[model samples]
Target: MRSLQPSRDVRIASASGAITDLPENLAELAKNANVDFIIGDWMSEYNMTTRGSQKVTNTDEAAFEQQFVDSLTVALPDLAKRKIKLAVNAGASDTKRLHNKTLELVKGAGLHLTVAWIEGDEVLDIVEACKKEGQRFRNITTGQFLSDWEYEPIYAQCYLGCFGIAEALKQGADIVVCGRVADAAPTMGAAAYWHGWSRNSYAQLAHSLIAGHLIECSYYVTGGNFTGFKSLPQSSDGTGLLNLPMARVREDGTFFIEAHEIPGRGGEVSVNTCRTQLLYELQGKRYYNSDVVAILDQIKIEEGDGRNSVYVYNVGFEKPPPTTKVGLTAFGGYQAEIHYFLVGLDIEEKAALLENQLRQYLKGNFSLLKFTTSGTSTSNPVSQDAATVDLRIFAQSKSRNDLSDANFLKPCFNMVMSTYPGATFAVDARQALPKPFNEYFVTILPQSLLNHTAHIPALDKSVRVDAPTDTVPYTFEQDIELTVDPIDLFSLGPTVIAPLGYVVHARSGDKGSDCNVGFYVRNEDEYPWLKSLLSIERIKELLQNDYNGKRIERFELPNICAVHFLLKDHLDRGVASSSTYDVLGKNVAEYLRAKHVQIPKKFLDRGRI
Candidate 1:
């Protein structure tokens, strides 16, 4: 059998956009000669919950994602002919089913391909045994015990590392299917397998891990979903759907990240775009992945020679964790929401009246009821749409009967005839129907408990991979205090009070229920002021309207002139169960940027602001 090119350099590309991203992009990825391997991340916290529910309602074969198969079918023939391997976590909860289906697709196309699947991330049995042994699966976000949940969990899985996938590839698999592994595990596994890196090659593994993290969201490292997106150079198409990102990784662990340079492709890759993704979902300086713990404080990014390219380097890593993180999803309850539009005069008064009516109608039926108003009504209305105010009310309860649309939405609809004139429903009435709320529980299981294995049907053999027995214990520590003195505003010549977006770029995301906001500046001189101005206290002040006295931790990445804040329990119950309008907290940083702040005139004078 032929092998990959002798060159130690490998180019890996990510085609999956988000957990719910379409797979059509894989067709474009297969045409690139520069790419040796392609990875698609098809699993997210919410995605896992949905897949788990599907598995419960149907057979294991129905648990696999068909979109992945459909997309792979479009690109499989091309990839096979080019000898480019594909890896994806689209298996969700059914790795074996996905593997078999992929094999059938390959064979049906008159192509002989080797397919492999990695498993053992599932821990339902372990969770059940732990429960029997009186072990409590505590909620990492709310600090509640699993026994407190209203419904038993449908599924439980742990985040595995890259070694299993690496082993599968080493056995000559053309494609690898994986269950719930770290989003970057496939990329790290490919790099390790290609370079024959030692399991303890902390530096190389860490670098590849960072690279995978950067491109895992496909074009996110490009201009997609970026706060500084307006600054990106436009393409001929004038659209922001930039070509997905691909990385040219060398054996030495250094890599150049850039998007496919097809003509008219949207999105731009630069230091700012890279910086935005580098801190996208980061919690603090210490980022934990199953493969290695990357110390992001010293990570650096620079412009690459290629068009719209950036180089990421200097990522440091420590030993792997002794236990892998486990995520368990339980049915919290039924949740229902209704949106009411209040247009015309006396908006505030109408809003108050509506809330009072809802409270009276839903006196004690729900465990949680929240009424939030969006789009303020101004004096002297210009237009009906402009004057319209949105009143969003959500309710959750342990009883499905309690959260039904009759109990939640009927009251609002019934009040429309009597309360505030011109009050009407803003969204489709179907949205008022109750839906299952999945509560997320995170914990850790010893490595020895998981039975990691890789199977190749062509060879009709399965290989059991042993967990690392020499894992090092982890010690928790408080965030490092800022040593640099705060900058004196008077030292600068003049200042202006404006939105902070003028001087800084920010990106925010959610990790379970915690919100991470990363803020960075373009000018090095402004770094001092940014660090001093956006302290923990100042951030809490800016978000004071939404602050709920939750724990917050701050960390600084001087190499990128950025500060990251982790807001614990800020997203309520996370995406699947959160009652907030912005469940992912993707707008947290944008909200901060819109806050009025004193900006140094010298920095703004550069005209880049």
Candidate 2:
């Protein structure tokens, strides 16, 4: 591929296989449209660990920014002469290595470019600071940070203010790299800065988040997937990271987002595509419109001369909160399973018979839960498994526990060993088969990422893990201290096997992004008093305090069983759920830690943690 001069303001060419072959097509499109900046959205989470990609330094993470740099290196000469600026937002999780390498990439090519990190350390620092303050749990919108310890950005973007880009151009930066800015921000900032718009201009920001969302995907607004298959009219192209061309600059220091396609690409934009984009960015719990304002509800659309343009105004914007987001994934090893089918004149009796037979046949290696069969829609069930009351038993331990423990699973032959009258075995499938092990992805709010806040109180409460009782009203923090030695933390009062009350158990399945942590308990009884002490607040408190002030307390640890605690302060309805009632759940975790020093006096006369 050769670099060619498309205009005095911008250079148009293909990056060959470096960035992608699409650059040539982009060059043709940019030449057709009066465009200034050519942005390439590169990388996504899956791209991070794309296995053997040269662009990424860490094999676990995808190397997209490198790809972007390599692509630009090919056209550096042409880009330098035309004063065309290249921008990309691709290194959201890779830290500064990607950003620094990009600067070096351009420099090595004899080109000088300015770089901005929108995600990485910027958000990490903020999150850490916020956590130190009071941020807790993973937020669905605005606050949640990147997951996938190692990942590639699906849409890496500079999210530069439209005007800011214009200035960077003036500053003579040949290229710009960013993590995430508003999609339209780069374009808007470029336009606004070039047009000399003020930061306080509400009208301009409103245009930005709207235009960003519109063209952030680039061609989506340009008629890439604008297809109204059913209506066969003007529709939106559901293409990802499509370029939008309605980016218009006005003399009044303001701009308008363009919803048009390449000048002569022969595509159609309509109310359908425009509205679809609106609905597309509406992921997470709610849509986070950039740092601007616009009357999205009042958005008007019109198509003229084969061009569908959206007239947008009055958009509202908010500054993102400072906090670090942590994503955790619980991966599984292996699993073993067994299936049993029982038949009888009484369905319930047959199911119960199978339970008894397995209990005696395999001693006590299984649990019996009535197979819940409801919500059966579709032409057939999601899986091919037949029979309504099939016992789905599973086991992980290979010891005697796996074959005969009360908590373990039973063997397949157990079914035939005690088959009922009409319990004829159908298609003899793998009877004592195995269960597929899966991992769940969940986000954690660690103190380090939450702004590094540590606030510990006096440790006047203590208990032993071996000691047992019903009521303690002690507080528990989700503080799983690595320094305290898990055994001691539990032995102090009652180290819990599971946090009591409502403990959110999330696992990554088909459609889940991360294993979510939230409340699952319906009542307080499921958790014994001592088991009900764990809570997020208490964890935060212990993290903040770290056994500093309030007289040290103590507790005890359990041997074969995990001690569970019920939280009082930390566990609340989702803050967005509107049912939190301003009640801050803090006691659960605090009481557990408080018992760290005084529990022996309260429950055990001689126990000490």
Candidate 3:
């Protein structure tokens, strides 16, 4: 495969539009950004599930996508004139229109969609195939099938690896548009593509993931959370942008992230902003990187001579645990809630009486999902001494259940009115409160798991970016390759202990025959035992026990805290494949329970926190 081309002096600029469409501010910000690919993230449910109910479709993100795109589209020619690139994930869930227009520009208009994570429409078909093979799981919220809907997503990219974005550039795509991808994908892809980094080099990959992580959230790195970062130039404006300036440092003992732009409009350059980003979520001894784990203990950052620029070096890494996969969704509903406090001299009696009183008023077709009292915990008790009792009333049913806000309203009203009459108490006549739908997210795993009963040919038409490879062939010591395939994404696995759940999502790495598996796990919970289990040594054991591959090979998993592993060449095409990892048994409910401890009300009240 051709290596990514070098565009070392590449400078990037971006724009962030004001909430009410402040094009000028956006334009100004754009001028200061000096970004290669301008990005806009507009999605109500972006951090939410990608595919779920039809009621809340990708269309939800459509309007914003259009707004941002139109903003860029309007400014495109000027950018083209200045030789600047524009891109955005603003298209969001329903990306058909964005995709169509982008194709028109790159293929017809001669503009580059400067983006990193772009999901091809073809992948959507992968989900259907999963269903046929029984790999697709169902997430009832949106009536969405579990497996990552490879094809349906107008934007279904988890995170863009380096290869593709660089490939697009080499193919002459000046402007690139992407679908749903990790916030950092675009920036990293751009850097690697511009740097001529080979796919095999872990260090560049590390740098790429690091750069991507910082810029991923536009202001997040710049100044969003620079707790003590005031070293570089500071922007006078309170917004993160207003700060002093400096030049940033990198692993090569050199400074990289720069805030330099046209004159002062480029704003302040500072080490503070960059430093905050570098140590944003530093862990003990080790800092996480996208490619190789970094031993933060060995890491260091420095600023420049008489100016703002921070430098990084000596970053180290740790072995990553297996990957886990989760899906995005939009579970829709309109709910009604009632909140009140039970008041009486007797605490337990007040609670019971409130429950009884409410039950009497609930005389309709709708069934209640929950009706309970609060201040019930023992360890961290909500002081109810002065208040007698506090109760919360709620119920949920299908829209077809034909229940309305009135069913809740009337019953709750009646409870207040008649409670004092029967129990002979006071303080009942007060207005009732209203609540919206008890929004819910029913998260399950492995959209589906199945054995291919038949062979399905590849459907490659518009784009021939031959499948990306994130799978790896694992062998313990000598030689053993487990179809010990990759982890499950949209689809849920048997045990919530989904062997590969940590991997957020992955695609083929390159044209290389080896499939590099990409695994992701939320960084907040880096379980020590599990982390230890995924040690490079253990992974070899797991891989060897499963597959018969080149034995005695170490694997790659970076940032076990936010663990994502890349398994290379572990799957077999056609009819010959088998592994405990590859064989899946589906049971949706049990899978959900594993994600959280199911404590009954009794357990919740009686057990310790």
Candidate 4:
């Protein structure tokens, strides 16, 4: 239980989680966090398509993330003054462009900074060549071949390892720009370079990878999107929502995530918060990265010695995966949506009337026409909002003209006077215009085929970083056993019907169209009940309509007392094209948490989660 020595710890802060994150975050962390390096993650599955399209169009001003350059403009002076290093995947589809932008920013500030960029993630042309050579380019989720894909492939980007980032930093790179390196690669690379960890340092690399994953989303580990946010302390401005986190990674690979206490920041880093993030967006116990495969079931998360700090350790690792995952972006088609409000009684009838009319009017005009209704009426309601419900009509088609026709809104407009009582449209005619959506495909390419390179502009040098020589082949379908002390629901003495969130804390996230929700209890005694209660069938039952005909996979983490369920192909085609209301699946956990269940009275005595 020794305190972390700032001199030895490879301190790093997550400057940005996504392209939409504020640019000032980099400056704030650099000016106050006193970290050795700062990292940012700027890519997502949807972004791969958008940025790739930008690149194809030669959109010079937006080929890369402008926010990242803006961030560097504000943080460059502070970073130079403090001699703090920086790394980011903000290059999106154009790493070279971002690299040049960084150099320009440094020169404009009259600062001496060695800027470097990592390349080899982009492989659109290679993938096309391989496809022509009979490489099926099979989809990982549905096992569908690329030939079966409806859209034409536009861009393909692979996930790279941390070696290139490490090599850049080793070659005196003050700023490292990257395109689609694994989300945690920057943190892993920084830790590896700081301790001179070898490529074969699987255990240490795995630990750092987990540490990187914990803080990669920035505010997530600090309290953002956390279920227990109500308990967090509010800032002077009366908002506890905005926050930032930094990690103190030891040479031994152990780390602690703490809120980077700036003057106006909010949020805390506790064991629960850390556990929530650790359980976010994972497929199972094994977290596969380009450099290492982390076995996460045995890991432990605990309260740290300092306030707003959570210690994480005990991670296991194996050699990296032989094939790296790749994302291909293609234009799905055009889509249009309209919302209608149905008030008070006969809500279902109102929705039914509109759906029937719309189906009659536009029956074969679109590829897909879907209707969804949510919200409930309270008995003896106090306000008009209480009795209001939402009915959404979503339509998608291969032909943009199909949805853009003036006749598209005619059915909606004609029914205004003939619709159910208290029915009203939520948007104007212009809001119903068609917008294009991208279809994202997940595949894999052999690591040996990639030419990962690290280039240092200041030194005029390029270092070739090869993929890992030692690797283990892995498949997500690998049999992972689940063992637990079974608790019979009927045998439990008495039960109180309440929302599952009363005794369980859960986190949910998306991967493509698939969603994973991990549920954990507050104490060990409640774990057995959690495991016994949340079966694959039970999860489908709780999900109700959303679980219709979709696959569900369940796994257990006995060490953390958690049960994880992966809902395959649940979000349609992910955030960009998903028709579901919970597009990113962020709300799936909350929705499941709200489902009432028969809970043991004994657990209720212990209080809410």
Top model number, TM-score: 4
Query: Mind sharing the TM-score for model 1?
Result: 0.95
Flag the better candidate by TM-score, 2 or 3.
3
Q: Tens digit of lDDT per residue, candidate 2, span 257-311?
A: 4543433234434544554444332222112332343433334443333445444
CA-lDDT, candidates in order = 0.82, 0.36, 0.38, 0.84
Worst 10 residues of 1 by lDDT: 474-483
Ranking by lDDT: 4, 1, 3, 2
Candidate 4 lDDT over 1-31, as tens digits, reads: 1222435988889998998777789998778
List model 3 lDDT by residue over 1-609, tens digit each: 343334234444334412233344335444444445544444323222332233254434343255565565456555665655544455454444565555555445465444222443213344445457775554322334445533232212222233444555555555555544334445545555555555444455555455554454445344443332333344444443432122232322123555434343223334435543443322223333222333443344445444434444444434321211223332223334555665445556655666787666665454334565555434344564554445555554435232454565665655665554233222342212322231222222221221111111111212333322342221112222222233322132222333232222111121011222222222223223233334445444544443435322222233332222223333221001111112111111112212332122322232221
Best by lDDT: 4
Summarize candidate 1's per-residue lDDT along 481-581 as a digit string, tens digits. Answer: 56357878668778888888887999999888888999999978888888888788888899979988977788888888998888888998788888988
Model 3 residue 604 CA deviation (Å) reads 37
How do all models score by TM-score?
0.95, 0.45, 0.52, 0.96
- Candidate 1: give its CA RMSD in angstroms: 2.3
Off by over 4 Å in 1: 1-7, 147-151, 238-240, 344-346, 379-381, 474-480
For each of the candidates, the C-alpha root-mean-square deviation to the true structure, in angstroms, is 2.3, 21.2, 15.0, 2.6
Candidate 2 regions exceeding 4 Å error are 1-32, 43-63, 70-78, 99-134, 141-170, 223-227, 230-246, 251-266, 283-290, 293-295, 304-308, 314-609
Q: How close to the true structure is residue 542 of candidate 2, measured as C-alpha lDDT?
A: 36
